[model samples]
Target: MSASELVFPPGATRRDWMADGILAVSLSLVVIAVPFVWLGGTQEPDPRVVGVSLAMLLPLTLRRHAPLLMLALVSVAGALHLVLLDVPSPSLIAVPIVAYSVARWVPGHASRSVLVIGTFASLLGPMRWFENTTSGNPSVDVLSWGACLGAVLTPYAIGRRAREVAESRGAEVRIAEERYRLLLAEREQQGRLAEASARAVIARELHDIVAHSLSVMIVQAEGGRAAAARNPDVAAEALDTIAETGREALHEMRRIVGVLRAGPEAGERPTYAPTPTLEDIPELVARTSDRARLVVHGEPGNVPPALALTIYRVVQEALTNFLKHAGASAHATVSLSYGPQHITIDVQDDGEGVEDPTDGGGNGLRGMYERVASMGGSLRAGPRTSSPRFRVLAPLPAPPPSPPPTHRRS
Candidate 1:
């Protein structure tokens, strides 16, 4: 909502008029009875004094609605009463009431004007009251002046304090609302970031599964077709490899699709095949081609599941790149080294291929790099100066130590 909508339209409500009306009527009746009380109703009171008193008291109806107008009316009548009458009346109570109303409802400049008018009245009203009786007693006049000044200033101070407190509360409410809006914005940004992360994972998974599987399948189909006339067994074996590769690709695709479709509210859990790990690297290399060989430098230890997945993807992507970029007769070697602090992988192919295998603007090498880097690992791929035309070297952090087993007390 805008600021204008939060503000009320100008003018008093029915409730304000009704409440102020009652107060004005009640005070007027008391003001009317004051002259009779002064004389004890034993004699007729002066008509002019009663008339001026009513003028001062009657404008209380506009005290909150039109405080400045009410103050003007009361102040004029008060001046008249001071000039014409010798005694004070109950109608004078309206002075403090008007002072408070002006301070509470009027703007700063206009409200401060009331204090000037009030202070003068405070001094003059007392002097007027004691002009005939005091016989020039300084102490008594000063005390009366102070008393009258207190009446006007006390209510004015209270009104100003009330306004300040209300403004402070309004400021607090605005701050709390602003903070709530910021919190909502922060949550929305986090949701968008999570969605982007999920999409990246999907893209990377699809690339790995489809790219590697299709490359192997294509090579097998070509070799199988070429050997169909000469060697029936070789052709048959190649067909089997293609079928197995296709089925594996389809299964991995179904896993990704099922996860995308399932929601927490659906109460459905799709059973997915276990992810490939470091132990599965040999089978992966064998399936790729007989041209690629695997070599290990150190003993394997307990590897974390995530690190295992990273290693498998890295090898898969490297072999895929080798097949895609290297010549037909090129031989490749995949070497793994396990150490106390890190695990290293090297996939090298002695093929006449592009100088920079990572230079092709394909997502295959990029996905491998991302997968490795996500596990606090580093990957490098390019043509080497030695026998290998292309080489991909990666060193990944070792898994943390497992907690010791606890024996049963019994």
Candidate 2:
């Protein structure tokens, strides 16, 4: 290792170097007093004491990293200091400090063993020191052992308590981080679900709009082609109707496209015309070239926009299904009625009762269901039980009734 590397490790801060300096200074005092220092009367010093104390204090810098080993070495050094020294040496104090670190780091069973050894050593060393200085006195030995045991226990207990508190704080931090991660994942899943739902709604709207408009144009085109052989004027009118239908579809396609383009892009907001409603039912019937009849009952009152669109889509899908599946000879009846608390729409057709390609689990039918459900409505679609006609009846919720008028007293 380089000289600088030996002095301080990589990323070692000023505070770390300061702490090492402090520990070094404190342990130097213990090292100086242990072996080389002379007692009050003795002129000569013991070389063995100096060697053992230096071994103990030099390892104090590495005590935190290798606490158990450091404590063991310091304990041996303290024992040797008691055995070889003639005069009392205070440098053996490094043992109790290392015992605290061992208790703070080592496993419970091993640390308990170390603590017991430390207490025994603390008791025996002082008593042995007394036996050498004065005569072996029972009361003096007891006092010395008790005082030394109490000193060793104090630091160990404090270190162990601090370790438990630190461990508890670390566990709480981990639990909180786990909970936050779970919450973040849940929010991400919710965003995906919401995006999927929005896409589904847009798909349904586009499917209903394009499918119904195209079905009518197809029927009219077939009629125009056949009728041209008999009456050119009638065929010409059908072509005109097709052109009008195409234009309407184009305009609506632009509106829906604009709606789809809504995002961070500048000036892309949709400019929707008034949406189709029950009032537009007559125009829808007329455009079918007398293929369907419109029958209205009760007062046609204004309804909510969503409910009106639901009624319109139901009629459109039913008529499209009739044209595509029931052959050109089929005729449909479109009916609407305003009730006290609801508005009902019924579309029925008398045609060849062939199965529809887009009938079972089809997007058109699914779209129809979505529309009705959005307006708090219910729809039943199938061939009539007794008749040959296919029918779809949708009943939608409406505004509540106004309070009835009270009779006036003249």
Candidate 3:
């Protein structure tokens, strides 16, 4: 709860003011009636005494609003009552109430003043009133002093304990709210990370599919145009290749869109074809052009699906870059070698290096590097140091060894 709620709770502001006003007025009336009641209505009370007593009692209205100021006003009036009044007036009741108010509402070292003042008043107030009384009990003065101290100290102690408990509860509430806020922020950050990862995956897939397909289509269209005037059959074959490439690109795009629309929790199974793997690399190279060739150096073993996809994408992106940067007559060699601890790929083109460095600074190389690195592999792409040819070399970490088979005895 807020500070205002502690002072005047919701829907209780007017009620609190009315109650405090009533309390102050009632206490003032009692202080006024005490002197008359003590004299049994036979003698008149001093006006100055009534005024000082009301001064002590009236500050109770400001107790919750301005506790320090109320205590100060009450203390000054109380001093005056002690010095000027010979009889013990009921207005002295405001002492304990003021002590409680100062203890509860005032915080820090300022509130400690209440204990000191109460202790002093508890000793002095009774002595000021009963100094001339010779009670039969010789310990009457000490007993009066004890009774007065108990009245003030008891309420003050209770108020201090109540304040401590309230503060502890408030601290716990604030800590819980802070923890909840941190949890929400953490969840939001994780969501953003997941979204960025998904986008990167989608972008890499689209680059491999669209860039390779467009490059092949562009090469075939040019070939078909040149051959159309010389030989109609060759031109027809080129046209068929271009059409097939476009249809495959469209199919892959539809598959991606279908996955996105279906969402992860979709009940129905996906109808799209399986992803490409190592077995598909030769067909991919053949589709690129007759100038491109693929050679395998070692026995191909079982490869993980994700690793297979990465290898296929590397080849696709390399050939796509080759078609764009290499001359129209340039020949390309794609070497795939399987080692005991690595799967290596080397794609090279025998043509002058990229004319513009800016053309080589696109997302193609970075995407390839990121894909390889995420699989605990490395990628290197640049012009060959020995010749004016572009080269892409990547070596991926080998998959973990399969567990040995175990035989069970019957």
Candidate 4:
């Protein structure tokens, strides 16, 4: 079937259809010229006889459409042409035309069966014609039989070759299409993972933003309330500080909100500025009440954006914990030791230790642990051996060197 399929149709090639057309035309031409060649002794050719020879070849054009059916019909006509004609007839060419179609379009087992039957005819067909006509030489009989076999096999070999080539090309196309589909699926999976990671980062930011800001505001409110009944100036200053802190928190909240509003599919990437870093820790301590102090021993060099944000979170969360659990008279120290290869943070509060665990514990410690683990760091929080103070010790590794950039030729 592959041999006879149209090249433009399905997976067939144009060359196959063209070859079929050429074979059909060649058979038709031989059928038309047979009458002139055979009318040697007769005065003129009979119109009805020539018409019958041409009529048998009408099925050749549709040979590829239904090869076996066309072969059966044309074969019956060929038998009649050989039996009736005293001279060589055009209808005789139909035998080879139908044989070629059967070999090309029929399945292999069926084609071989047809070929075996045709071989028998190749031997007997010439004897049938030679017996009714002249008493010919024995070698000429052999030659006619050889011609029949050669015609049948030439096109069969060509058809088999065409089928093999088509199947090979079709397999290659299928493999390429399968590879493309797998690559597209892999890209889609990567995109989904990236989106999930971005959302997780955003969730962490939301928690830290709201939690830290609210904790500071609560302490300021409590201080303002205690002084409200006494000195009016001190209470007013606390109110002004609270207002300023609230406004600053609101601005940071807007940045987080803008990112959420843009959505994941936004064309222009949303940008937010002035992210908290190591340098901002000084400003952070200045904003808090004077009972807590931050001390740095070494120069904290430049760091990655993510690590800087992590450092800011560690300080913020530790301060929030001190405010919540420590007594009013307690003092806390936030010490940072920036070494050549590593950085360490020590937050110690000399206040009443964490209360009994009857109250529901918060998720702040768990969040802080996860944050430290993500940056390949370690954190320890517990009471010191000699003192009744709570201490948090964290050690972070230094970031790797940046890769050098390439310079294009001028």
User: For model 1, how does the per-residue alpha-carbon lDDT over 1-410 read when each residue is reduced to its tens digit?
Assistant: 33332222145788998998888888887778766787889877678777887888888888777787888888899899888877787788888888888777775566877788889998888778788889788998988999988888999998888868867998999999999999999999999999999999899888888888988998789889999999999999999999999999999999999888888987998767788888889989999998999999887789989889888888898898887888778889999999989999999998897444333366888888889999998999888976549899999998866789999998
lDDT of prediction 2: 0.74
Clashing pairs in 1: none
Candidate 4 residue lDDT tens string, 99-207: 7666665655666654775677677677776775546777888788899787777777776677667678879999999999999999999999998887777767776
**Which runs of model 2 end up more than 4 angstroms from their true locations?**
1-26, 29-49, 86-93, 106-113, 132-143, 265-273, 299-302, 355-361, 386-388, 401-410
What TM-score would each prediction reach against the true structure?
0.82, 0.79, 0.82, 0.70
Rank candidates by lDDT, best first: 3, 1, 2, 4
Q: How far is candidate 3 from the true structure (C-alpha RMSD, Å)?
A: 4.7
**Model 4 lDDT, full chain set:** 0.73
Cα lDDT of all candidates, in order? 0.85, 0.74, 0.86, 0.73
Ranking by TM-score: 3, 1, 2, 4
Give model 1's clash tally: 0
Residues 1-410 of candidate 3: C-alpha lDDT, one tens digit per residue: 55654443234266766787789999999888877988899989788778897899888988777677788898899899888887677788898888887788777677878888888988888878888884656589889989989888888888899879988999999999999999999999999999999999998888788888988998889888999999999899999999999999999988887877785678666577789989999999998998999999997687899999999999999998998888788999999999889999999999774553425357888899999999999999988998879999999988867788999999
User: Residue 260 in model 2: shift from native, Å?
Assistant: 2.7
Q: Candidate 1: where is the Cα deviation over 4 Å?
A: 1-87, 105-110, 354-360, 386-388, 403-410
On a 0 to 1 TM-score scale, where does candidate 2 land against the true structure?
A: 0.79
Question: Every model's Cα RMSD, please?
Answer: 4.4, 6.1, 4.7, 6.4
